[model samples]
Target chain A: MIALDYSQFLTFEPQHHWRIGIAIYLFLGGLGASMGFIAALYKHIFKKDDPSMFAWSTLLGVLLVNFGGIFLILDMFVWESFLHGHITEIFKVLLAFFGAAVFNGNFHPWIQWGANFIALFSLFGTLWALSQADKAAILNKLGFLVKIANLLKPLQSVWGWGTIIFGLAVAAYTGFLLSVAPAIPAWSHPLLPVLFVISALSTATAWYMLWTYFAKGKDEETQKVREHVGHQVEWADIALIGLEILAIGAYFNYLYYAYAGGKYVFHQMLSDMGFVIGFLLVGLLIPWILEFIAAKKHIRILVPLAAILVLFGGFLLRYYILHYGIYTYPWPS
Target chain B: MQEQQNKQLPNWVFVIDLNTCVGCNACMAACAQENQTPYWNEKWRTKVEQAEVGKGDNIGRIFFPRLCMHCQNTPCYYACPTGATYKTPEGVVMVNQDLCIGCEACVTACPYDARYRYDYEDVEHNKQLFGEEFSIHQLPHIDKCTFCYHRITKGLEPACVSTCPTDCRMWGDLNDPNDPVAEIVRSGRAKPLAVHLGTDPKVFYVGLDTLPAPAKEEAE
Candidate 1:
């Protein structure tokens, strides 16, 4: 017989508070943060003279983070209030980074911390991306680009490291975002942050693998660099996917025995075909096996395919966590 | 902390005698009129829930009136990112509409499932029903049972407490020794739900063991 502190669960109700906007916000935020971190990590280690995928990765990081902020806006915007609409919401989000009271620390620290990290990462990442040696003559001719790059040229190393620090922090913060809400037992597990951070890193690696592999306008020298970096990224992603599997397995096991509503979530996830087929089979296991085979056999096509699936799996993880959380009622028994 | 800041404000408490509630949803109807809650969407500030309690010989059915517990250790207050939700000196939790950004974190964090979004579209509908201005809901914010913060602060009991035909519901200052509600709670006749959560709810219930045995006929 299955043993439990109490055979009966506390509250068998699934939480329906946060909708799809919050899920998309988490997915985009994690993806953007990790992308920024990986871009800086590559530039310092790989030592590229010309603008490579790393430069574009930083550009993507800035864009993705800014785009992710839109979802947060929609989620938090109060339409009925006197102050409303798109511009005000954007201003409010930006204002929070500049010491606005949007994040009240009397209660939650995760959202506040995440905001600071994203802001810092965006600032440094933009500076670093602008400083890259651009081949496009038209871009270099722009007065602001020339002036900004030249002015900030000396502190390029500091900017690169800043991106790496805050990027990693923002990625990890996404996990802590949901973990702090103890009302949802399925999400309150400490392992959530560990799982999310690892997944973020893996997804970022997958993105780099795709970018380097898919680049078209590269010179012979840059092409050679891209190929070498692409190979290493593929191998790194293989390890990350493996680690992700281990983390998820450990998390699932712990959730079952630890939380009153956790067992329900565990079974609920297992019962859902999306978790099994979409996330596990197609997203994780199959892609993992394909990447391993592609690495061993030197099949170039399989790497991109695996990377695509890995990215899909990464997003699905966020979706399931946000959507499927069940609340266990604390009642007098 | 709230009491220390405002010495004049009395600690509020709600005592619901479960035995006296006759499954008549007068409290729910009264709350709907007073609060203009989203009754059309099956959403209510207060509800009469038909609950099956106990097991074996102890098993009995009862209609329990449920609402925000207004905990001493308020989870919703802590969970709010904008400090929109806060407890007043009188111990009634309230959402400051001006500050509420509608993040819904407070809604998710409340274990009692007390809060709901008062969206923009509903205001237009409410305007059509009961003119432009209605019951401190001009702006969209997280709505919950405020324990009639407006009425209670102005020397009146909550709509539900005042309207109950059976006198099942009681509203009084917990600090006042003369108040019977405080006596009922202190004497251990009424107990708060889910004490393990550490919410320290101001609302309490009595006679949850079984439906009050049918009132005995008085002897001649």
Candidate 2:
């Protein structure tokens, strides 16, 4: 309903020196990266057996999802210029699949390690870029690293910065991203980032567990590997949930502050009116409940569902933050 | 006019006198009118109404006309990914539309929600509003108040300062001790918005008694 207020509105200046197109472009890039992971994960966990399916599927999903949004946002006639978007999209798909196969077995350990390193770098680089966006000097410095592997050394440096660094980079950026526009009072809280990081950690752990469960085979060594992976997954999930509780508590504290200041509009929306019900129902409670059920019965099916729900809820959390914040703070035209 | 023009024009500043000012929203309205700002539905600039110190049975209001504070060390300038927003040598906080990626980094970095996205028009209004081939980049990126830089560059006071019927606003320079701004600071009559924000706001307030408490101010 609220989306109607800002659906396809253009905020660009006709004769201005610059364009708003870049935002659309960057959004697409980010979307590609995120959707890539989603596609890869879904294909790997759900639709296994294409041999090269995992890589191709994930890369294609990421590019298409991200590019699709871009085209729609820009009102580009995709039918007219299908090749423009499709060429790069298809190339990346094939490349991703080929790379995955080449790096599949232990025989290509160095290449596998390199690929993993690149993936890790991309992950942490995104987190760092989000964090660095807060500071001019740091962001400028980080902006210089254009390649994936080049980002790894800096990412390694970030590892020593501890959970707080990762937490601040990933979490605070989430809040900053949501809150900066001011139109979304519901998304304006400082605590949203913390919640985001907790959600991320939870999703990551759940995915790891899902992967291990599916990868298990009828052998002692394989079982041992699966067991270890399972332990890591469970521990990560517990830690993520614990951190989420802390973030939720902080959000309440922020609300109290806002309420006392007579800016209770967002507080009322998030807490009293059941707007955040989905967060509690799907994001928080559902995965928690499913996880508990799985723990008691060892039902492997429930594990994937729990992981999927938790991840879906994480995305929903971001969506709500964006939309609700916009709802609360319309452009004071 | 020639002499007035030749004499180095005192760099204009905005001094908000908190003591006599009532939070009536008059200045804010006048500001929007003078600037032809979009609308409240699209606020380019805004007045932050703060709850001032209250007496036993009486509550007071402080009207802080908040625009881009145009700080010397603007955080938004630094956080911008595309180098879209930056400060000029004359200390105006401005955004370069072409360079802006619209990632909204500068928008987010600012504690003040001063930055906003200007995106593609909705499908229904697309052709009616903008004609065909409506590019998103054709829209504005992050839009904010620029202290009427166009007018200032042409040796005119900002619209908001000129339009304040109550004379609640004053413009001068921080560098010139003879300026009202310098005098006020020297006399310790000047204050700021959220001093603890480490933002080091250049927009100073005089007679700031009507502003809300810091705790309340921070939340807004």
Top candidate when judged by DockQ against the true structure: 1
Docking class of 1: acceptable
Put down candidate 2 lDDT per residue, A1-333, tens digits, no spaces: 001111122121111111233223323323333333432333234432221222232334334333533432232222222344444433333343235424434322222232333344344434433332322222334454424324443553353232223223422333444443222334546666556656655665665656566665346654664565565566557667767867866776765666322144444446633436676677777787777777667776888788777766665555444433322211112
lDDT of 2 by residue, B1-220 (tens): 7666635544445676754455566656765565444443455565644433334434334444566777665767655433457676567888765554444546545655565654322222333444446422243356677777777788777776776667666666766777765677557677665454466666777644333343334343
Candidate 1 residue-wise lDDT, A49-122, digit = tens: 43646666787887887688677665765332334444654455345423433343453546666667788889
* Collision count for each candidate, in order: 1, 42
DockQ for all models, in order? 0.25, 0.07
Error of 2 at A34 (Å): 9.6
List the lowest-lDDT window of 10 residues for candidate 2 chain B: B119-128
Interface RMSD for each of the candidates: 8.1, 15.8
Chain B TM-score, candidates in order: 0.88, 0.72
